[model samples]
Target: MNLLRERLTTPGDPGALRAEEGERPQSHARAYQSLKMQVHQLLLSRIDLEAMENLSDDHLREELGLMVERLLAEENLVVNASERRNLVRDIQHEMLGLGPLEPLLADASVSDILVNGPQQVYVERRGRLERTDVSFVDDDHLMKIIDKIVSRVGRRVDESCPMADARLPDGSRVNVIIPPLALDGPVMSIRRFAAVPLTMANLIDFHTLTAEMAEVLSALARAEVNLLISGGTGSGKTTLLNILSGYIDHAERIVTIEDAAELQLQQPHVVRLETRPPNIEGRGEITQRALVRNALRMRPDRIILGEVRGAEALDMLQAMNTGHEGSMTTIHANSPRDALSRLENMLAMGGMNLPTKVARHQISSAIGVIIQANRLTDGRRKITSIQEITGMEGDVITLQEIFSFRQTGVAEDGRVQGYFQASGVRPRFQERLRSRGIHVADHLFDPGRRME
Candidate 1:
């Protein structure tokens, strides 16, 4: 299609086999742009992107590559065999993969891929974001990429549905917001995870937690003590939840609920529930709270919510107390106390007009541990505080810090130096763990040596 539009248009320097238009660097770019736009338009008019996706990868690549070569030959474009193959792969990625953003997705270190507009792309690697040359040819090109993602997952995004949440093939979380709602042309953000989920040992290596803290959490999970992990946005809450949930007994049945199911729990007896958005007709919506209610009937030994947002907190707390112990959930908050506060607020959001005392009592009785995670300036995520919920004292829910990460000073290498030390206060549930046959070393709770 593009071959028809671009003429040989005055050849480049002698002996330059590349069909690129410009004699200088800038001219070569113009030629590439002209060539790419032609390919994009040609493929759209001749083939259905969705239909072609059904083909096997090898078949698709072979078929698409030949068509690109055929189109280029017709355009009288002159490129060596190597450039032709590269062009075909790029076109194939644009058609089958994420187009211009494909390379960024392939890079393991890139934790996030942010696109402000068609011409601007940024990626976060090693905790810092920097601009990259990757970009869409135009806004329409970007929308094509977004639509390709949403439609596959049975979602839609347009003027009518301008914003959407979707995940890529590799389980990378994706968000798409179009014009009118987006303000920019089309905004897309992708949050990628480690190819292999991090383990407690892995986190210990990263200094996210000490070996002793990890052991205590393992005992808490084994003891069936309900835990609520809290942190701000991008503070490693879900990652921590995934790591901690790994400690659940394999024989136990675990039910996990999420808006976009992202947990990769390895247990054999696990049932996963994902919330659904309202359909195009504004019907068939399933919410997290509804799922929590249904999970109780399914006989889940533990209910793990990806994140507790909104009215679901009430049901989750109720579920945790009603014979379903050791359940875990994540929430957005700054500290252990704030996590409780947010859970309370979410309980109110459920339209349960119970008194504050009643809600506090429910939280205090249901939750046994609060793990607060934080992302330091150097981009390391560490458990800042781990508090044990003793019970309600008056109208307040009493909590004692079991362990905390303290920043002694900055390191010479520019990395923030810190150590996770146990708090002298022993957890009230230590005896409970003992009853459940889960034990912790006594030295781990020595206040003078542990807390310091």
Candidate 2:
């Protein structure tokens, strides 16, 4: 008799039966996977790809479902109606979607997907990493999925070029590294995009920043204050940038540049540009610096760079200095001061022969504010600091903190306990906001007020 049938029919020890019940789901999952693979192979051998190409999507799906049902019956598989339906869906996913990852991608709660290899998959849900039961048959199976992803976006990855960046049709960012570079096997990480992008009100609801801080940010954007958003990876830098960009005038011409197009701007007059990687021949490559120079020629009222990492920093700084008042960008840094330092380093990468004092002055004049976002130890993301650049004092760039989140301690449940507070010192940009008729109340900057 089969193990399941035997356990049900000959129940002797209650403790042993309880132990077996605990393992039933995993055993059933393995059986389902085995059945799915068998039926998938049979369906693939029977279907005519050339004939199916002419069919509409709905028609094709209907035909495939009939074929899958026929194949299961031919193989004498004894599955229930629900199991049969699932088997057909799995086959469809294998042929038409991302195979094993289709379900994870459909889940709105999953923010990130990390595939280490065929046997290991992890996902980030509610800011915490958890392992999932998803797996592929082997390394070759994983490689095929990777190839399908990159090819759809007109990108390639092989031994010669084992690293690639691409985005899904829904705009989720994907990074893949394989083989010699990835010692374990093919590895892929996906940063899922939200269907409905988070707004400033959403950030306040999540306690990422206070309502007062959001008011200041909204005023800065409306007043055309050049701002720099500084944060580390996965700290919601791009999300915050998107919210700030929403405040820009709808009539203004906005141009956005990024390695992969992730920003979801709402303005009608906005133009989005993305960088391109070199072909196998190592030719026909386009960099962000090239796009920035071209954006300036396009007569953009504001330039939004997705991130300033290398030589593009100099171009972006020059654009902001030369009439682009409300331009914005983000940089990966630990703090606001560190962000300025990174900009100085990137300027040197552009092969500029400017002195240290000259470089500092250029940065101080171009960037009016630096908003620092951070992902704390407990997996909570918050805007840690907002500092206004008040021009240069001697050789140093003067920065005054306007708002900050102060961490008191970890709670009993391990959540980061913190409060957002104003820094008392009024920002220099207030006058500029008033000049633009954007009034921010003085009470918003009171140091005594705390948001917990």
How many angstroms is residue 329 displaced in model 2 relative to the true structure, after the best TM-score fit?
0.9
Q: Residue 145's C-alpha lDDT in candidate 2?
A: 92
Model 2 agreement with the true structure over 1-452: per-residue lDDT tens digits: 01011111112423211223344445677767766766676566556777777777677777778777765664455679999888888778887788999999999999999999999999999899999989987898899899999898889999999999998988889999999999999999999999999999999999999899999999999999999999999999999999999999999999999998899999999999999999999998999999999998999999999999999999999999999999999999999999999999999999998999999999998999999999998887999999999988899999999999999999898999979999999888999999999999999999998887
Q: Which stretches of candidate 2 lie over 4 Å from their true place?
A: 1-34, 54-59
Per-candidate TM-scores read 0.90, 0.92
Q: Which 10 successive residues of model 2 have the least lDDT summed?
A: 1-10
- Across 347-416, the per-residue lDDT of candidate 1 in tens digits comes to 8999999899999999999999999999888888889999999998899999999899888887787688
Q: Give the CA lDDT, 0 to 100, for residue 83 in model 2.
A: 95
lDDT of every model, 2 decimals: 0.84, 0.89
